[model samples]
Target: MKKNQFDTKLIHEGYKTSEYHGSLTPPLFHTSTYTFPTAQHGEQSFAGERDDFIYSRLGNPTVQILEERMAALEEGEVALAFGSGMAAVSATIFSLISTGDHILCSKGIYGCTYGFLEMLENKFGIEHNFCEMDTEEEIQNLIQENTKVIFIETPINPTMKVIDIEMVVEVAKKNNITVVVDNTFCSPYLQKPLTQGCDIVLHSATKYISGHGDVVAGIVVCKAKELADRMIPIRKDIGAIMSPFDAWLLLRGLKTLAVRMDRQCENAKKVVSFLQSHPMVKEVFYPGDFKSQNYFIASKQMKKGGGVFAFTIDGTKKDTQEFINHLEMIKIAVSLGDTETLVQHPATMTHAVVPKELREKMGITDNMLRMSVGLEAWEDIVADLQQALIKSNSNTVC
Candidate 1:
């Protein structure tokens, strides 16, 4: 297959035509081990002298195809898949950092990622600093000689803050630090972090890449062969390898990512406009909002505004719950990047483990809500929002 463009790459870049002329979709190879042609061949495979699969933990044909496709989409040299999003996250971080190393991360990270960093701090004696401010000077000052990784999530978790990936890479490169970007919200279809100078880019493939909420998976794409080599041991030893069946599912999902995201981005923009005009909304944090402070960064880095938005409502946690409960079509859920719309109160749900004071300080208040816009018609979604807002207003009246 010619490695043409992203959309073409999505369908054909990964796997070659099977010699057997099998089904169009890659079939599930549910074998534990491959039979060796001879004793010397087995010895060579086990010794890492030849490129051959030794165990299921090491690799599978289906997983390899997904990895290749992901690597192409992400524009990375190689990609690794994990059983779950956190598995990929943990394996990547663990592969990079040691006991005495330091990490500089964004303040408004995904809840579980924040927890992972906290655990490492307590148990591993590693050092870290959370920087809410993404100004180049602020981040540069925070970096120490021991800083091994500069971790960030663009259009950050629930808040939708955009970090300048180029600026981050420039700063990290000065001190020879690794730049690990979680490109979950903006899938490879919308943004390619590795091409923007990030050392590694990982995603919760269960999200946009899968397009459906049926599977839970994660993948990491790295620019350097060395980083890919480093992660291989951690992936195998940690035992978080993605299942062959899930890999096949992910491959199928990748085929239509471009189309799904196109509609998703459009719907998200309409939703943002509606929220911005609503009387109940206090603040709207969509990258498409040109007046936003993060707009400049978003314009520089992302091709689209992405499919997620976070806005503030004029109410408490109870009030927010009322609004969510009143919604007709949008599901009140925790996980994001699905076919159906999802809305949730980040402070109380996603970021609940975060310290109260810190959460409040970061603008993750009880009044805030995060929405993952789906493929639903814009008018229907807006109508649902209208009804929910009515309920929210009525609750205030009482």
Candidate 2:
């Protein structure tokens, strides 16, 4: 099947019922270990002579189905599932480089990702350099002989900064470094980084991929068979594989990804428009907005601006708090890409782990708000924001 037909592929690309008594849906193989028919068969499985599952930590049939479906969605050679998004990120990074190697990363990434890299640098001696990564010159200047990987998060968490994937891939190729893109925001429906020459794409499937926000999972999709092969052992040794039930939930989530994302994107566009025109909103950060700094890049690489965007209120941190507190329809939350609209303050919530000075340097200000527009009616979402702004302004004046 052609991978380009994404919506069709989402439902039909991964599993076939003929292998499991024509059940229609993939079954959750809840066993921890698989039994071999004979002693020789078990020996063969251990000796790598037989392609079979031996243990759940190493592999599971249900998890494999989800991996295959995600691979198809991302147009990747293979994919690996993890218990959580951080496991996928850490395992993939550990598999690619040794302790002495250096990594070049985007400045505005997820707070947990930043914390993980810092821990790796301090504990394992792996080095990392963080920069805006908005230009080829910036990337070129940061490249060092010891640099082994270039990691980036486009439409960066909470800030919505869009990085140029193709340009970064070109720079990595020139430097003989691997490029990994954290595609949690766009998912595969909106953007496929592998097709843009990125070596690997990672996702926090707990977000858009699992649209209902019920499961916490992560996946790493590899463009090359060799990279997938290298990552498998690391995942097995770390024992961070996804459970069969979580995999099943993620599989169900994949089926509706195309549809859920379409509506969410539509809602986000309307929200951006409302925020941009509001008097209390100082700046709206959405790549889809024509006035955005990264609008051109977002237009070139993504099908639509994703559901999440950031905006700044024309007031202090207290005003921002008032705005969030006054919000009646939108929920104050950290994670994005859910069925319900969510809002968060990065400086106090997501990026709190980073030093205040560094957070400020990354453009995550105290007054900034990150919003994840949901499947709610656009009018209702707008009205909620309108009233919240009015209430916040009124509170500030009094």
Candidate 3:
């Protein structure tokens, strides 16, 4: 079959109806183990001489399909699927680094990722430095002889701070460091980091990739076969493999990702515009917002501004709670990239685990709100926010 465009590829890539007796959709192979055709076949498979599924923890037909699709989507040589995003994150970190090796990462990242890195440092003797990865000079200043990996999250969680991936890649190349990017916020539909020189692109498929918010999964796409080969054993031994059921769900999600992302991006742009102009909003952090510090870099790397954005309400913590309580259409939720619009307070919700001083340094303030715009009509989303803002401000003297 001819390779089609991205939208067409979403449904057709890495799959064929003939393989499943003309079934239109990929069949879910839910069995924990696959039967070998012969005793010799089983031995060969176990000996790593045959490319066959032996166990679900090692590999599965349904999971393989999802991995192939993710690899194609990410423009990577191979992709590995995991039970959760943090599983993929931890596996990648462990696979790449050794004790005494150092990792340089962006200071503003998911709370769990921060915690995991801390755990690695405290328990395993791995060292890490978290800093503003805004410039080559800053990155160089922080790098040490032991620095082996540089990890970053673009359009960083709750802040929407876009990192310059290509620039970072250039710096990493000079230092012989591996560059890993968490592309969860801007799924492959919005950004392809590997094309810009990233070594690996990671995602929390629980969010936008699954689209419906029904599955919790993660994926790591490697630009080089060597890197992928190294990660496979780590994942297999760790037993954090994605389930056949969730893989099937992710396959279904991939079919609609193109359309879902398009509509969500449109809605997000409109929502950002409204928030930027609102009297109750102090600041809006969105890639598409021209006023954003990283707008130019975002435009270069991403096709759209994505569905998620952050903004601060002009109020105290009490007023922020009032606003959240007044929201009727948008749900107060921790996870994002769902069909229904969701909003959360980052300082108290997603990034709450981070030290208060560190959270403040990262600009995740108590009054700041992260909004994940969905496929809902933009007008309704804006109306909901407008009312919430009104209710939050009504009791205030200012």
Candidate 4:
């Protein structure tokens, strides 16, 4: 119809107030375990004959509601929640491949995700390769017999590079490789990777999905029930399941996701425009910007220029840090998707775990700064950033 289905699904999906004594809000089921009516009932649950929850580690009512809601929002067959974004990443990888398998990834990814990939190679025989994924030839050339997963982050972290999801999926389908997309930056509101023929879509629910600084959570949505069935045991055994309260909080966050993301994306465009025109900004990496290399692909994939962007200052690392220090309003922090705008130096902060040479290959330079725009007024954000740039100018000789 009008395409307002998503906004409505965010608030009302997977929740029936009548199921909870007519309470307007979904009641939080905060308990460690569930009691079975009898030994026979417990046996039925343990044997998978009943849908009753046996323990919180395995499942919970509140968490189940969140999972159901997220599945609907992301257009996936099923969804699972995790304690942290890394937990979701680790579990999904562990579930999908064997010890000797290989993974192909986007050149730029979250610093922690990079770390986890390294760990996989070191501890296990599982290896990975990085590709720009710019063309079908490039993707086909990189595929190996052992490559089991094609993991990518579109509008990739720090660099804001947007890969064509359908292009990757098309090549992946030919080889029977699982396509896993990290949708943390876009959230389901902007892009639905599963609908583009991906196998799994993931998110650091701590960011845009939660839309606040308070919660740390993750979600994994699988297009096929068979794929989700494979990951559930991993989540349970790893013991990284999301807490009941976190699920409750996320449900609250999802209710406002459409509004919060709309505001943040709008503010980000205005801020990026100012920075692009500013003298101190040498380069800007925003998916929505017409000048960006990724602009066309992003326009084809994403609904908006997401809330995050990156840029390089026309100065030294010292000058860059000085600019961040001089900001009076925008906070110098690594996390994003909060009500307050946040910024961080990728080379020294979030992506520091990645080796300097490798980080450079990913275009994460010392003078580069990544910002997550918030729900603040566009004028105020631009004004604060302008003042900081002015203060940083004095730190350099020019």
Q: Please, what is the TM-score per model?
A: 0.97, 0.98, 0.98, 0.98
lDDT for position 219 in model 4: 97
Give the per-residue lDDT of model 3 (tens digit) for 121-223. Answer: 9999999998788889999999999999999999899899998999999999999999999999989999999999999999999999999989999999999
Clashing pairs in 3: none
RMSD (Cα, Å) for all candidates, in order, is 1.3, 1.1, 1.1, 1.5
Which regions in candidate 2 have their CA more than 4 angstroms from the true location? 1-4
- TM-score computed on alpha carbons, candidate 3: 0.98
In the range 72-120, model 2's lDDT, one tens digit per residue, is 8899999999999999999989889996999999998899999999999
Best by lDDT: 4
Off by over 4 Å in 4: 1-4
Q: lDDT at 166 for candidate 1?
A: 91
Residues 61-97, model 4: lDDT tens digits: 9999999999999999999999999999989999899
**Candidate 1 lDDT score relative to the true structure:** 0.90
The lowest-lDDT stretch of 10 consecutive residues in candidate 2 is 1-10
Local accuracy of candidate 1 as per-residue lDDT tens digits, 197-234 = 99999999889989899899999999988998999999
The total of clashing pairs for model 3 equals: 0
Q: Which has the better TM-score: candidate 1, or candidate 4?
A: 4
